[model samples]
Target: MTAQNEVTFRLTRCRRSVPRTRALAHAVLGEWGMSQDVLEVAELVLSELVTNALRVPVPSDRQVGVRIARPLEDGLLRLEVSDAGAGRPEVRAPGDEETGGRGLLLVEALAHRWGVEERAGGIGKTVWVELKAPDIVPEPVGREIAAAMVRPGYRLRARGEWRVVVSVRSEQCDAGYSAVVLGLDEGPALRVQAVEPLVVRQCEDVMSAAIQLEIAP
Candidate 1:
């Protein structure tokens, strides 16, 4: 699909919510049939945005937000994270002793192209990145949707608040599976269950390989 066929989403800014941010990208990319290389770049941009949002200070009335969109000129996936912080981000050289300051550097290297912009709200800035996407789309067939996704046949166990597992029955059908599986921190989560007719036309038209979703407790 062309960039015009792309999708966009926005979310609040919070450091601990990075996993939630990553999950948003995962679900959207999955719908688009994007590639791993593209997803990697997307994740890198997401990381930078999340870090910047967490590090910056916001106005008393404002919160951070993230926007993911695709520009129409080409099939470029763009990621933008905005916050109400006061200053623009400076591209800095990493220092040997410095533990921080390397996130943007990673974004600079991985994204096909990236930049920062002032928010329309006029309160903060949004750092963005754009990259090419893979051409193939998953037929959504031969793939099982579970309460949690794990590399098929593999079980995930946790001592904390997260719980779920996903398996890849067919790598060719479900390529570029996200290795980063996130468990819920609190509250109920949603899980997409495997369904018949992996592919479907719409709510009324059902396919043999469809994956159905259910609410999880």
Candidate 2:
């Protein structure tokens, strides 16, 4: 059975939280079997969030919180940093020569989406960013599209056979490749360099589910 990918850590509000949470993230993400590219970005994003949490003006009794989870189960990795501080974070456009105020800038550029949310207790807030796993590769055949055609339930023809697309997700596949999820088992997922001609159809019966997203700039 595949292990569930989720982790949470509460670190001291001191400066050491920066490196401590980063180490934890490294261990947890490695165990979750993330690729090197995904791991590199995860570490960078984790470090930035932890650094920001440590800088927040929280009381001495409160500790900084960090949560990492594959909430979507569709290749989306979420990294969150929480603090019981009064300040709400916002991205500031720093001048070219400025010394600071560019953390969220990197976050926005690397993450697919990001946002801030009030903690359940209402005294704190969690800053989060979702990073898409590097899996989906755009097939090079007819349409020069960047995304895959996901029609749930119906089997699609590819590589001279028909197979079901159990799930659809956006991934960071390089320019000319197609991401194929063979199945949920220990089988290998293929990133075929090119896709053969096939008829693509929309999933008519599957109603589009509206997800409550909290993406911010």
Q: What ranges in model 2 sit over 4 Å off?
A: 1-3, 134-217
**Model 1 C-alpha lDDT versus the unseen true structure:** 0.56
Best-performing candidate as measured by TM-score = 2
Candidate 2 lDDT over residue span 150-209, tens digit each? 334434444433445454433334553444332311224423322323333334533244
| Candidate topping lDDT | 2
lDDT score at residue 154, model 1, on the 0-100 scale: 26
TM-score of every candidate? 0.56, 0.59
Clash pairs, model 2 backbone = 137-177
What is candidate 1's lDDT per residue for 115-180, written digit by digit as tens?
Answer: 878889776788878877646332222332342233322222233212333333321124333223
Give me the runs in candidate 1 sitting further than 4 Å from their true place.
1-13, 134-217
